[model samples]
Target: MKQVVENIESKPSTPILGHVSPSDVECMEEIAGENWNEDCAVYAFHSESLFIIPKQRNIKLSLATLKSEIYTISPIRVFDQNIRFAPLGLLRWSSRSRGLHHGTHRMHNKNQRKRLWPIWVLLEH
Candidate 1:
């Protein structure tokens, strides 16, 4: 896959959505690789971690081709600042551990509310 990286300095403050930086955008782009796009909105934290919500969750603004196979919409954690898909397919969980290239793992089936589950937040959510 191919990704497009933009060199925007400041983070974008999307009023209703909150603040997201160029570095965050760059990180998501890198992960989705050929699948990334500008419209993609990401949830990033101070720990330099991120969560992905799609380009436009509601409609026409919807992507022509739904790329990710996993139905849940949890964001992958990309730490090394590198992008790579996990080997195992965690339908609803994030990677078991942190860092890049370390693929997703099986999800804990305690409850089924979160479409996508982040490994760390599994206990709380």
Candidate 2:
């Protein structure tokens, strides 16, 4: 007896609903740049940080104070200034621990692991 093997092709999955358009993205960028009201300016310590909120919430809250109060919202953008790399501190959580690469151990390579030393820099606004 002989067995036959067949190859099958798969179709693309359905597109996500409410796809964002260029215009929508532009509008959101414009809205995000807004300073809001005087009250908000006082509370907004980080001007560079962008707070993302839904259209409905933005429309409902006329005052920036109220909008600022609503902590729950979509993910906000992390400004470059807000990000830092400290070699000796908790800030280096994103970086790998200082030592040989895990693969190097298996390979028995004694050469340097091309260690990265990230210096911490503080800039004044």
Using TM-score as the measure, the top candidate is 1
- Give me the runs in candidate 1 sitting further than 4 Å from their true place: 1-45, 57-97, 102-125
**Residues 2-117 of candidate 2: C-alpha lDDT, one tens digit per residue:** 98878878655553333222223334454434332211100121222222233433322223322322221222222354532111112344222332122211112367555544
TM-score of 1: 0.19
Q: RMSD, each candidate, Å? A: 17.7, 19.3
* Per-model TM against the reference: 0.19, 0.17
Instruction: List the candidate 2 regions with Cα displacement exceeding 4 Å.
Output: 1-5, 18-51, 55-125
